[model samples]
Target: MTTYNPNQDAHYQILREMLIEARQARGMFQKDVAERIEKKQSHISKYEGGERKLDWIEVLQLIEIFELSEVDFLMEFQRRVFEFNESTQTKVLQNVAKNAAKKARVRAEIVRLMRENSLSFSDLAEPPIRTRRHKSNR
Candidate 1:
Protein backbone atom coordinates (compact mmCIF):
# COMPACT_ATOMS: atom_id res chain seq x y z
CA MET A 1 0.00 0.00 0.00
CA THR A 2 2.93 2.33 0.66
CA THR A 3 4.09 1.71 -2.88
CA TYR A 4 1.98 2.58 -5.95
CA ASN A 5 1.88 -0.96 -7.36
CA PRO A 6 -1.61 -0.54 -8.87
CA ASN A 7 -4.77 -2.42 -7.80
CA GLN A 8 -2.73 -3.36 -4.70
CA ASP A 9 -2.68 0.28 -3.56
CA ALA A 10 -5.62 2.41 -2.46
CA HIS A 11 -4.60 5.01 -5.04
CA TYR A 12 -5.17 2.54 -7.82
CA GLN A 13 -8.46 1.39 -6.27
CA ILE A 14 -9.66 4.97 -6.29
CA LEU A 15 -8.71 5.24 -9.94
CA ARG A 16 -10.62 2.09 -10.75
CA GLU A 17 -13.63 3.37 -8.87
CA MET A 18 -13.44 6.59 -10.86
CA LEU A 19 -13.35 4.66 -14.10
CA ILE A 20 -16.47 2.69 -13.18
CA GLU A 21 -18.15 5.84 -11.96
CA ALA A 22 -17.34 7.56 -15.24
CA ARG A 23 -18.99 4.78 -17.19
CA GLN A 24 -22.06 4.93 -14.97
CA ALA A 25 -22.22 8.72 -15.29
CA ARG A 26 -22.45 8.32 -19.04
CA GLY A 27 -25.21 5.71 -18.64
CA MET A 28 -23.20 3.14 -20.55
CA PHE A 29 -22.98 -0.59 -19.98
CA GLN A 30 -19.79 -2.62 -20.03
CA LYS A 31 -20.74 -4.12 -23.38
CA ASP A 32 -21.31 -0.67 -24.83
CA VAL A 33 -17.95 0.51 -23.59
CA ALA A 34 -16.24 -2.59 -24.89
CA GLU A 35 -17.68 -2.03 -28.33
CA ARG A 36 -16.47 1.54 -28.38
CA ILE A 37 -13.01 0.54 -27.16
CA GLU A 38 -13.00 -2.49 -29.50
CA LYS A 39 -12.62 -4.85 -26.56
CA LYS A 40 -14.65 -7.72 -25.21
CA GLN A 41 -17.27 -7.12 -22.52
CA SER A 42 -15.20 -9.49 -20.39
CA HIS A 43 -12.18 -7.24 -20.95
CA ILE A 44 -14.09 -4.31 -19.49
CA SER A 45 -15.59 -6.52 -16.79
CA LYS A 46 -12.28 -8.06 -15.71
CA TYR A 47 -10.48 -4.77 -15.12
CA GLU A 48 -13.46 -3.14 -13.40
CA GLY A 49 -14.02 -6.24 -11.29
CA GLY A 50 -10.31 -6.26 -10.28
CA GLU A 51 -9.74 -9.64 -11.88
CA ARG A 52 -7.28 -8.10 -14.36
CA LYS A 53 -4.72 -5.37 -14.08
CA LEU A 54 -5.18 -2.25 -16.22
CA ASP A 55 -2.17 -0.56 -17.70
CA TRP A 56 -1.67 3.15 -18.43
CA ILE A 57 -2.45 2.90 -22.12
CA GLU A 58 -5.74 1.13 -21.47
CA VAL A 59 -6.67 3.72 -18.87
CA LEU A 60 -6.13 6.60 -21.29
CA GLN A 61 -8.07 4.76 -23.91
CA LEU A 62 -10.97 4.20 -21.55
CA ILE A 63 -10.93 7.82 -20.45
CA GLU A 64 -11.31 8.85 -24.08
CA ILE A 65 -14.15 6.40 -24.64
CA PHE A 66 -15.91 7.62 -21.53
CA GLU A 67 -16.03 11.15 -22.99
CA LEU A 68 -14.38 12.56 -19.84
CA SER A 69 -11.58 15.08 -20.15
CA GLU A 70 -8.29 13.24 -19.54
CA VAL A 71 -6.77 16.15 -17.67
CA ASP A 72 -9.81 16.54 -15.45
CA PHE A 73 -9.95 12.79 -14.86
CA LEU A 74 -6.32 12.72 -13.64
CA MET A 75 -6.66 15.86 -11.54
CA GLU A 76 -9.77 14.44 -9.92
CA PHE A 77 -7.99 11.14 -9.33
CA GLN A 78 -5.14 12.93 -7.53
CA ARG A 79 -7.59 14.98 -5.46
CA ARG A 80 -9.47 11.86 -4.39
CA VAL A 81 -6.28 10.01 -3.43
CA PHE A 82 -5.20 12.93 -1.26
CA GLU A 83 -8.68 13.17 0.25
CA PHE A 84 -8.81 9.48 1.10
CA ASN A 85 -5.26 9.21 2.44
CA GLU A 86 -5.10 12.42 4.48
CA SER A 87 -4.33 10.54 7.73
CA THR A 88 -1.95 8.21 5.95
CA GLN A 89 -0.22 11.17 4.33
CA THR A 90 0.14 12.91 7.70
CA LYS A 91 1.73 9.81 9.21
CA VAL A 92 4.11 9.52 6.24
CA LEU A 93 5.13 13.17 6.61
CA GLN A 94 5.74 12.71 10.35
CA ASN A 95 7.90 9.63 9.69
CA VAL A 96 9.88 11.57 7.08
CA ALA A 97 10.48 14.41 9.56
CA LYS A 98 11.51 11.91 12.27
CA ASN A 99 13.95 10.23 9.89
CA ALA A 100 15.40 13.57 8.82
CA ALA A 101 16.07 14.45 12.48
CA LYS A 102 17.73 11.07 13.10
CA LYS A 103 19.93 11.54 10.02
CA ALA A 104 20.91 15.04 11.14
CA ARG A 105 22.00 13.77 14.55
CA VAL A 106 24.02 10.91 13.01
CA ARG A 107 25.76 13.26 10.61
CA ALA A 108 26.62 15.71 13.38
CA GLU A 109 28.17 12.92 15.47
CA ILE A 110 30.15 11.71 12.44
CA VAL A 111 31.53 15.19 11.86
CA ARG A 112 32.47 15.51 15.52
CA LEU A 113 34.20 12.12 15.48
CA MET A 114 36.16 13.08 12.34
CA ARG A 115 37.29 16.31 13.95
CA GLU A 116 38.15 14.70 17.32
CA ASN A 117 40.17 11.88 15.71
CA SER A 118 41.65 14.09 12.89
CA LEU A 119 40.28 11.51 10.43
CA SER A 120 39.13 12.04 6.84
CA PHE A 121 35.76 10.95 5.45
CA SER A 122 37.39 7.78 4.10
CA ASP A 123 38.43 6.79 7.63
CA LEU A 124 34.77 6.40 8.65
CA ALA A 125 34.13 4.26 5.58
CA GLU A 126 36.33 1.35 6.68
CA PRO A 127 35.26 -2.26 7.22
CA PRO A 128 32.84 -3.06 9.99
CA ILE A 129 34.31 -2.81 13.53
CA ARG A 130 33.20 -6.37 14.26
CA THR A 131 35.16 -7.81 11.32
CA ARG A 132 37.94 -9.86 12.95
CA ARG A 133 41.22 -10.78 11.24
CA HIS A 134 41.60 -14.56 11.09
CA LYS A 135 44.75 -15.92 12.70
CA SER A 136 47.20 -17.84 10.47
CA ASN A 137 46.49 -21.61 10.78
CA ARG A 138 49.82 -23.22 11.53
Candidate 2:
Protein backbone atom coordinates (compact mmCIF):
# COMPACT_ATOMS: atom_id res chain seq x y z
CA MET A 1 0.00 0.00 0.00
CA THR A 2 1.21 3.50 -0.78
CA THR A 3 1.79 5.87 2.09
CA TYR A 4 -0.09 9.15 2.25
CA ASN A 5 0.52 12.16 4.48
CA PRO A 6 -2.41 14.45 5.26
CA ASN A 7 0.00 17.36 5.99
CA GLN A 8 -2.15 19.35 8.32
CA ASP A 9 0.13 22.32 8.00
CA ALA A 10 -0.71 25.82 9.20
CA HIS A 11 -1.67 26.61 5.61
CA TYR A 12 -4.32 23.94 5.69
CA GLN A 13 -5.54 25.21 9.05
CA ILE A 14 -5.83 28.77 7.77
CA LEU A 15 -7.70 27.68 4.68
CA ARG A 16 -10.03 25.58 6.78
CA GLU A 17 -10.70 28.47 9.15
CA MET A 18 -11.39 30.79 6.25
CA LEU A 19 -13.91 28.36 4.85
CA ILE A 20 -15.64 28.02 8.19
CA GLU A 21 -15.68 31.79 8.76
CA ALA A 22 -17.11 32.43 5.29
CA ARG A 23 -19.89 29.97 5.91
CA GLN A 24 -20.61 31.34 9.37
CA ALA A 25 -20.75 34.94 8.15
CA ARG A 26 -23.48 33.82 5.76
CA GLY A 27 -25.41 32.36 8.73
CA MET A 28 -24.57 28.86 7.62
CA PHE A 29 -23.68 25.91 9.82
CA GLN A 30 -21.61 22.83 9.23
CA LYS A 31 -24.65 20.85 8.12
CA ASP A 32 -25.55 23.45 5.52
CA VAL A 33 -22.06 23.43 4.04
CA ALA A 34 -21.83 19.66 4.18
CA GLU A 35 -25.09 19.37 2.27
CA ARG A 36 -23.83 21.70 -0.43
CA ILE A 37 -20.54 19.81 -0.70
CA GLU A 38 -22.18 16.38 -0.38
CA LYS A 39 -20.16 15.53 2.65
CA LYS A 40 -20.95 14.52 6.21
CA GLN A 41 -21.18 17.11 8.95
CA SER A 42 -18.53 15.26 10.89
CA HIS A 43 -16.23 15.53 7.92
CA ILE A 44 -16.66 19.28 7.82
CA SER A 45 -16.21 19.59 11.56
CA LYS A 46 -13.05 17.56 11.48
CA TYR A 47 -11.73 19.54 8.59
CA GLU A 48 -12.40 22.85 10.28
CA GLY A 49 -10.89 21.70 13.54
CA GLY A 50 -7.74 20.67 11.67
CA GLU A 51 -8.00 17.19 13.02
CA ARG A 52 -8.19 15.84 9.49
CA LYS A 53 -6.45 17.07 6.39
CA LEU A 54 -7.94 17.89 3.01
CA ASP A 55 -6.57 16.66 -0.28
CA TRP A 56 -6.26 18.69 -3.50
CA ILE A 57 -9.73 17.70 -4.64
CA GLU A 58 -11.19 18.59 -1.25
CA VAL A 59 -9.46 21.97 -1.38
CA LEU A 60 -11.14 22.74 -4.69
CA GLN A 61 -14.44 21.67 -3.25
CA LEU A 62 -13.93 23.94 -0.27
CA ILE A 63 -13.16 26.94 -2.48
CA GLU A 64 -16.29 26.37 -4.50
CA ILE A 65 -18.45 25.85 -1.46
CA PHE A 66 -17.13 29.03 0.16
CA GLU A 67 -17.59 30.99 -3.10
CA LEU A 68 -14.00 32.21 -2.88
CA SER A 69 -12.28 34.03 -5.72
CA GLU A 70 -9.75 31.52 -6.98
CA VAL A 71 -6.83 33.87 -7.64
CA ASP A 72 -6.92 36.07 -4.57
CA PHE A 73 -8.31 33.53 -2.18
CA LEU A 74 -5.61 30.94 -2.72
CA MET A 75 -2.85 33.48 -2.85
CA GLU A 76 -3.87 35.22 0.36
CA PHE A 77 -4.46 31.99 2.16
CA GLN A 78 -0.95 30.80 1.33
CA ARG A 79 0.59 34.07 2.31
CA ARG A 80 -1.15 34.31 5.67
CA VAL A 81 -0.43 30.75 6.60
CA PHE A 82 3.22 31.07 5.69
CA GLU A 83 3.55 34.24 7.68
CA PHE A 84 1.75 32.86 10.70
CA ASN A 85 3.84 29.70 10.85
CA GLU A 86 7.16 31.10 9.75
CA SER A 87 9.95 31.13 12.32
CA THR A 88 10.55 34.85 11.85
CA GLN A 89 8.47 37.39 13.75
CA THR A 90 8.91 39.87 10.91
CA LYS A 91 6.79 37.71 8.68
CA VAL A 92 4.03 37.70 11.27
CA LEU A 93 4.10 41.49 11.46
CA GLN A 94 3.85 41.70 7.70
CA ASN A 95 0.79 39.46 7.79
CA VAL A 96 -0.79 41.66 10.45
CA ALA A 97 -0.19 44.75 8.36
CA LYS A 98 -1.64 43.11 5.28
CA ASN A 99 -4.74 42.07 7.21
CA ALA A 100 -5.23 45.59 8.56
CA ALA A 101 -4.96 46.99 5.05
CA LYS A 102 -7.50 44.52 3.77
CA LYS A 103 -9.92 45.52 6.54
CA ALA A 104 -9.52 49.19 5.64
CA ARG A 105 -10.21 48.43 1.99
CA VAL A 106 -13.37 46.55 2.90
CA ARG A 107 -14.53 49.37 5.13
CA ALA A 108 -13.98 51.84 2.31
CA GLU A 109 -16.06 49.69 -0.01
CA ILE A 110 -18.90 49.65 2.50
CA VAL A 111 -18.79 53.42 2.77
CA ARG A 112 -18.85 53.74 -1.00
CA LEU A 113 -21.88 51.49 -1.22
CA MET A 114 -23.70 53.45 1.45
CA ARG A 115 -23.07 56.68 -0.43
CA GLU A 116 -24.06 55.18 -3.77
CA ASN A 117 -27.33 53.89 -2.34
CA SER A 118 -28.02 57.18 -0.58
CA LEU A 119 -28.77 55.34 2.63
CA SER A 120 -29.23 58.05 5.19
CA PHE A 121 -30.01 57.62 8.88
CA SER A 122 -33.67 58.17 8.09
CA ASP A 123 -33.61 55.13 5.87
CA LEU A 124 -33.29 52.98 8.94
CA ALA A 125 -35.62 55.07 11.09
CA GLU A 126 -39.26 54.21 11.71
CA PRO A 127 -41.84 56.27 9.84
CA PRO A 128 -44.26 58.58 11.73
CA ILE A 129 -47.81 57.28 12.17
CA ARG A 130 -50.83 59.41 11.42
CA THR A 131 -53.87 59.34 13.70
CA ARG A 132 -56.79 57.29 12.31
CA ARG A 133 -60.02 59.16 11.64
CA HIS A 134 -63.06 57.78 13.47
CA LYS A 135 -66.00 56.68 11.28
CA SER A 136 -68.46 57.71 14.08
CA ASN A 137 -68.04 61.35 12.95
CA ARG A 138 -69.85 60.46 9.70
CA lDDT of each prediction against the hidden true structure = 0.87, 0.78
User: TM-score, each model?
Assistant: 0.58, 0.53
The candidate scoring highest on lDDT is 1
* lDDT (Cα, 0-100) at 5 in candidate 1: 55
Per-candidate RMSD, Å: 8.0, 19.1
Off by over 4 Å in 1: 1-8, 89-138
| Each candidate structure's count of clashing pairs | 0, 0
lDDT of 2 at 77: 82
lDDT of 2 by residue, 78-114 (tens): 7876777565567668999999999999989877887
Model 1 lDDT at residue 77: 93
